[model samples]
Target chain A: MQQMNQILRRIPVWAVYLIGALPAPWLFYQGLTGGLGVNPIEALEHRYGELALQLLIGVLALSPLRRFLGLNLLKFRRALGVLTFTYVTLHLLVWLVLDVQVPSQIWADIVKRPYITVGMAAFALMLPLAVTSNNLSVRKLGPRWRSLQRLVFPAAILGGLHYVILAKGFQVEPLVYLSAIVVLLMLRMPISGVLTRTRQADST
Target chain B: GVGLAGMAQGAAAQETLEPNTWEEITSYNNFYEFGTGKDDPAKYAGALTTEPWSVKIDGLVDNPGDYDFKDIMSEMTVEERIYRFRCVEAWSMVIPWNGFELADLLNMAGVQEGAKFVAFETALIPDEMPGVRYPILEWPYREGLRLDEAMHPLTIMATGIYDRPIPNQNGAPLRLVVPWKYGFKSIKSIVRITVTDVEPPTSWNMSNPREYGFYSNVNPNVNHPRWSQASEREIGGGLFAKRIPTLMFNGYEKEVAGLYEGMDLSQYY
Candidate 1:
């Protein structure tokens, strides 16, 4: 585990960001070249959204990995979160400019559709977290910065819910994503309580 | 002279009808019996055996029997129909379907006095259709229409697209095509068609009554629960193509509006 952490530390965070951002252009190019099948707009939109969800799941998995397995990926969390937001933005753009394309309908969907409403809310929650994901804000806000970053918990849940509600029929894929997010959040709970109790015992 | 004038008008209309390519028509499909994904049917439906197919025509009809595909094709007058195909998911396509009027087939069986609705069902081969094995939707995908809607000239039992026999993915052998309604109403790979008084249980409507209504006519004013139906993305339109405003009854308001003259479309939708 120590060796693995050492290896992960050597890998630059910018490399993570670059690797994560690669799919966006590649997917767009695929859509342009007709490689995304018949309905490229829908395919591209779904792919971007799914990638965002996968990245969100990765972000959620980080704390649990460090807590249980002691495999610290804390260095890359910001990069992962930023990349997740980037994919989410791309997903929204694909829907707005390519998929939906109408000005009024775009606003109407965000207001009207429950799934879209949830998705936009999730995106809105990420805004401040994304803005403050820097060294200056981390130093200025101190402990409060950690509390603000915890908004990702609800944001991730909402993201999963958005997918679950958006799917046609009772699809298992969306349910699987939602369940994974819930489980990851649950895993963060008991270990923290145990650590607190252990520290109190040591003080006594 | 009137017939000649009508034929001339039809030819003029045909000139405006831009049918999607054979590849587009075949590849992009919503046959949930094959699978839910747009390309799932194209990937998996090749295993389906459509040859020597038969349609079991039953319920309130004078003659009820399993009619062979060859016999039905031989009996009917096949013609080309170019239609605006609209899906409930807010996608549109122009398709050139080759088939005969559904009314001709229904009439051949001799509709009984009690027959008020026409219910259709798709073939459910579990071994061949990998999708049916999972309960994505109630298997043997079902759909129905009012007797009048069934009798409409625009409603057809399509066998071919682009003048060739339909590929398995696009509902091979036989399929329903009701141009005015959402594409799900046009059930694919039909196996049974029943003439009955009661409104039949449609697969999507049965799955979610709030979202999918039985009378799923194309209405721009009526929004789907998840998305706005006011506009549609044209299927063949590339990534940068603009969305077009969806038309009332999918631009067949002139032909089909009379069928729902007094009824509320939004409520029905």
Candidate 2:
């Protein structure tokens, strides 16, 4: 814990921002320049999806890190969450621009294609959470703020489901994401094993 | 002129393989890369390395031998034709493929009388293609065709696409593209083509034999238990258009469906 805290302190906030945002432009550059070579659009979609999913995972990991590692670095969560939304938005944009140029087709894709439907559902769920994540909304919502923000958990779950539904087979990769969400959600539950561990720790 | 050469090759290849439309040719795909997505081949296959490669031809062929990938390319004139690559997953693509007829290559291999099936293997190095490393299925990659299907005119020894040598990700060097069958039946980065009496197991079919079959002829009536094959989305054609009705034998029914006239495709599919 001490070592992690030390490393965290040494790492400048600017470094994290730069590191996180670095790929955004680089991927964008790839898209603009046609660096994807043979299958440019697919390459764009694949990278955008991967980045969005990773950001979602990062958001899920935040709380566990705070509790287990004593890293109360709460300030980064909002930015992290925003970055996740940004990538998801880009993923959608790329799909719209490259794959679905027509509005009717876009609507049809949302209606058809189970994977696309799940992804659209997750994206829609994320919008409210992203909007409510601001301090202004939190202040406006008051005690209701926490309840509103808690939607992120479900949003993340749906995002993961969207990914799993698109994967080739029900292999272990998707299962890992599902497991992580389960752990994160369990950490929030009052009656879970994590609560038992915390209670035992306090007594000790 | 290159145009004349291409036209001549296209003409010869047509009798030997499925002649494709420009839309069908450009939008089609092979499932060797991008893990079975119709759009995946256009993107991920660029990472494939096709040059300086060799194909190991084995099994029951009388003229079993290994040849340089380029040697084969030189032996056959590469012709560009558009093919509608219909995936079993219901999505489709019109791909412009550059290669020669599979019949020409099969005749060169000199199959033995008893050889009833032609099983082909893809060069699936798990380290290179991380997707293969996953325990997704029993084997790395595999595809096969019954003897008559193997000898069919539409089967082509494909190497290049988009008017150039195929980008590595699309199966550089050489691969088999069976236009009428679903994309998976069109084996990519072919390391070997084996003639065998025993029905060789295919990657998807082996993973789920009932879902995939040895004679995976393109038929709309026969649906993959997992998804309907009755309709297909022509990839890169545009997102606006919904899936079109899949034709029996991928529109080569006039010539090939007679081969399976009485045979129940649903049972065989």
Candidate 3:
């Protein structure tokens, strides 16, 4: 475990950001060259959204990983958060400019469709988190920064719900994503005290 | 005179229409019996056996028996029809289909006096169709239309696209092409067609009645629950293509609007 931590320490945070951003262009290139099948725009839109959700799951899993297994991924959390926001933005852009071009319909969909409404709400929640992700805001806000970042919990849930609602019929793939997010959030609960109390009671 | 005017208009529409390439039409499909993904049918449909195909004509028909594909083809006069194919998923395509009017096929079987509806069913081979193993939709994909809609001149049982027999992915040997309705209503790779008095259950409508109505007509005003139906992205329009406004009844309003004259489209939708 110590050796693994030492190896992880040597990996710069910038490398995480660089490696994360690579899929964005690689996917775009594939879409351009007919590699994303026939409906490239729709495929590209879905791929970006899926990637964003996966990264959001990664961001949510960090604290739980540290708490349960003592595997610290604190250094890459900021990079992962930024990357999640980036993919989310790309997903939104693909829907806006490529998949759906009409301005009125875009606004109408955001307002009217429940799935779109949830998705936009999730994006809105992440906006402030992305803006405050830097060190300067962390220093200025002090402990309040930690409280503000907690918005990610709800944002993650909403993100999963957006996918679940958007999928046609009952699809297991979207439900799995929502389930994973819920389990990660449950793990973050302060349960050590509860566990110790149960152990004490059993001993008596 | 009205028939002449309609023919002239159809000719004009044909002149303006640009049918999608054979590759695009075949590769991008929504035959959910094969799978849900657009490319799934293309990837897996090759395993399906289409040779010696036969269609069972039952229900209220006078001659209820398995009609061989070759015999049916020999009896009918096939022609090209340029149509605007609109999917419920808000995607559009222009297709030049070759087939006989569905009314001719129905007439051959001789519809009984009380028949009010026509229901069609797709072939369900679990070994060939991997998606059928899971209940993505009720297997043996079913679709139905009013007796008049079935007899309409525009409704065809398409066997080929672009002067070639349709590939399995695009519903090999035979398929329904109801130009005025959403694409799913035009059931693919049909094995059975039944004329009946009662309204038969359609696969999509049975799955989600609120989202998919019995009519399944293309109406821009009526939005799907998940997405707007006001506009559609044209398939094969490349990455930056802008979505165009969807037409009422997919631009066959003049021909099909009278069928639902007194009914509310929004309620039915």
Most accurate candidate by lDDT: 3
Task: Order candidates by DockQ, high to low.
Answer: 1, 3, 2
lDDT tens string, model 2, B184-255?
A: 788778888888999888888767676778778888887665445676655443323344678888865655
In the range A7-57, model 1's lDDT, one tens digit per residue, is 999999899999999999999999999999889999999999999999999
Which regions in candidate 3 have their CA more than 4 angstroms from the true location?
A190-204, B1-4
- Residue A40 of model 3, lDDT score: 92
Local accuracy of candidate 3 as per-residue lDDT tens digits, A1-204 = 667778898999999999999999999999988888768999999999999999999999988676556688888999999999999999999988888788877898898899999999999999999999999999999999999999999999999999998877656679999999999898767685476457668879
Predicted candidate 1 versus true structure: per-residue lDDT over B43-129, tens digit per residue: 999999998899999999999999999999999999999988999998989999999999899999999997899999999889898
By DockQ, the better pick of 2 and 3 is 3
Per-prediction TM-score to the true structure, in the order listed: 0.95, 0.68, 0.94
DockQ list for all candidates: 0.72, 0.10, 0.62
Query: Which of candidates 1 and 3 reaches a greater lDDT?
Result: 3
**Model 1 segments beyond 4 Å from truth?**
A191-204, B1-11
What's the i-RMS of each model?
1.1, 6.4, 1.3
List where candidate 2 sits over 4 angstroms from the true fold. Answer: A1-26, A102-112, A169-176, A189-204, B1-100, B104-116, B123-132, B159-173, B189-199, B208-269
**Every model's TM-score on chain B:** 0.96, 0.83, 0.98
Better of 1 and 2 by TM-score: 1
